[model samples]
Target: MSAAEVTAMPEGRGGRMTRAQIVNAALALGLIGFGLGAWAMDETFLVTLATKVAILAIAGAGLNLVLGFGGLVSFGHAAYFGLGGYASGILAHHALNYTAMFEWPFVFEGTTSMPVIWLTAMAVGALAALVIGALSLRTTGVYFIMITLAFGQMIFYFAISWPAYGGEDGLPIYVRNGFPGLNTLDPVQFFGLVCVVLFAMLGLISMLARSRFGLALQAARQNRQRLMAVGIRPGGVLLVAFVISGAITALAGALYADLNRFVSPSMLSWHLSGELLVFLILGGTGRLFAPLAGAGLYIALEHLLGGVSDHWQFFFGLLLLGVVLFARGGVIGFLAGGKRHG
Candidate 1:
């Protein structure tokens, strides 16, 4: 980033943090504090909840790159998400069973290593996004949305029909994947790992938004003609963003699969794609930390409301409507005092 860009960022007046910075700091630190508190209390479930927020936040952040910045309403992001999950699940399955993934392809074996699984998941997501986005980007508006959704469903059905792993029944990991020197079985340990990754992703995203390519992305979104006049290709920029989005979300899916010790078609379903969008909208579309805020609010509300009422989504839907209508900046924007575009 240029010195001008770095200097232009708001750090607040009189040596104080900006409102958005304060809120962003709280969101990041608060999740760590909450997880630690849960660990102190031996509340494994709550720790898991915090981890879920971090994972979902990662997923939401990825989608935000595409929808919030790239101006692509991808209703099929779950395709990449589930692909990542299955990637993890399948690798773990073969590793545990002492079987080769395929006899062909140089006799490659599965792995229980978290790092390996994450890399593989991200690659798969990126590749899928490349092909799908290439085709889907050919259209605009609702046609693009439908095409993405159609691709997602095709993946979803393929997962169901393929019984080698689990098919419609889903595949089980049996045991959580391994991380270097960490007790993967311990909720707190896993939560710590996931939170670290989430914060790193947020930082990377923040930097990307201020980078040259990031500026081009926004320009494409705001004015394709203007970006084209500047000799920037909107299609290429958007496609890159879409692929990056898929890869990040897929990483989250892999972590999620590890957390749950299972993989299912549900991960690839349109419902999840919609829920991700809801998280983005709820947290604030363009906000740097919107994913965490949105997913945290969503899971919190679901937990609180589900205990009191079975039809909790009805109330949640109403709240979502309110956010869409009034809180365009989402929870972060509402609290931080800024425009989504700003």
Candidate 2:
């Protein structure tokens, strides 16, 4: 068959493929092919890497809610990350020990249910964001950045000093959390779970971006005065965005904790917050799937470079610096050509 015929056949079999459809199909095939290859070699490392990509992408999506859509540059999202992780770790510990979380007013017991843990994490994260966003939103520019950073550091130190859950030592999740019938310990199963969460978050964010509220949030980000003059409260818009962003990031934290079967204060550190920001920039902020692309590329680079040398991080840093200086749009922009707005 001719090249055109071969291409058309794949598209026809794929059922009316658009650009996105073709890209997604290619990605799916690539992943399936890679998984089969890994299985052949008795290796699951790539599966783990893909999980990392999904988890990070989830966090990046949360960040994108604020940074990309709301035009808020928060330098302290690691606070939510660490908070979500600690929430899971603490609950799992209490449940495993069959102990009550607190006896002051009411009884709170831990369970192995993923949904319950995720809800708790999201709630805690939203509350934290509400408080932080309230204070941070009072300022703009450098002051806003500094305030967010301070809040993040505050949580980081608190986690380090808290004697519970091993304090600085971190807590281990002895068993993978249950999700109905799935054996989460299985790489493929866990990977599937991650993919589901990532896609769900992507769909939700995409919908939000197209909603009236999302438009207001974007308007507030671009020109707060104009939004206010148009009868929209910018502060309210920002607050909602911040809360949603935190919740999404928190969800990611829960998954990440399960992925490693552990939680540590380091998860809430400033470095992780910076890394999330880096992923957004690297992937092209505001693009729906930029985080996924960026996370995949970052993890792949880390894996390949680490295998090559011990000082790979230094090279990674240099490469990132080059990207920042020269590449205005990042991986998605490079792949997709230019930015498109709705």
Candidate 3:
């Protein structure tokens, strides 16, 4: 190409890039730059904080499925969250203690593999959801909300009373879990794993929202009678969504347990359940990437504000209240203008 022609070309393209492509390219470049910067900094605290944000984002995304899309408005999701955490902790404990988890007709042993832990967490969470959802789904409006809250409290109390795995004292992971060839003890590798999981979950959620099942679920959420008339069982659809939602949250729980290297009754608390919902509201519900963005911003605010003043949470509460009252769509909706479905 001639020098004159090259000079006349747009920076992003050989000629000129469309607005959409330019925006996407900029975002990709920005993320790459941020990752490179974090790698170079090698700051333990920041990296750890970022991992926490990612984990919280995953939890938020799961909760969003129920609250935002399904319109379930569950207040007891922390039960699944804590269940996933404890599952990992208990398994790791048995493995480290050099004891088999079970020896039935078949042998089962504890494992630190990320994949195994994830599956265990999902299974446990799904089972819990099955029971809770079955009962909770029977009631509608305020009754459903109360039942879910009650179930959450029940699990929390059970965790606190259980003498195993430190009870109220909590269980420590000692070392981060392993992922095949990856050295999870390394901050960057751990962070990368978290990022991969977060993105994967995001992708899964997006695809689910586009699927026919998702359409039916949304319809059931809006009008149960109508969906039933259309030959779709509303309860069944909601039940499936609930299970998937719980499973995703449980995956987050496993990551969280590994992140903190601890699992306590506190993980099962109603307060945590509320916080997960809060993260969804703060980010904007229904949008695919809202949870991730919201979690990142929330953590950043917490870190910055906490460092500035001991009364930061008080002010943070005020900020959240403002968003709830004034910002209808959360931070993402505010930035993006209108709410984007799917």
Q: How accurate is candidate 3 locally (lDDT)?
A: 0.79
Task: Report the lDDT tens digits of candidate 2 across residue range 1-342.
Answer: 111121223333445544444443454455545655665676788777777788898999899889878888999999998888888888888888888999778887787778899999999999999999999999988888889999999999888898877889999988878788899889878888877898889778877776778778778777999998989989999999999999999999999999998999999999999989888888777766667767777888888999999998898898788778887667655665554321
- Give the per-residue lDDT digits (tens) of candidate 3, residues 1-342: 111111233334567663333432443344334554677887667777777888888888888777776788899989999999999998888777778888997677788888999999999999999999998999988898889999999999888888866878988888778999999988778878887898788667756665777777667667888998889998888898899999999999999999998999888999888888778777777655557667776777888999999988898899899988998677765765553221
* lDDT of the candidates, in the order given: 0.89, 0.81, 0.79
- In terms of lDDT, the poorest run of 10 residues in model 3 is 1-10
TM-score of 3: 0.89
Would you estimate the TM-scores of all the predictions? 0.95, 0.90, 0.89
Q: What's the CA RMSD of model 2 in angstroms?
A: 5.8
* Candidate 1 per-residue C-alpha lDDT over 1-342 given as tens digits, one digit per residue, 9 for 90 to 100: 111222246444578776777788999898999999999999999999999999999999899888877778999989988999999999999999999999885887799999999999999999999999999999999999999999999999999999998999999999999999999899998999999899888777777777887888877767899999989999999999999999999999999999999999999999999989999899888777888999999999999999999999999999999999998878987887765222
Best by TM-score: 1
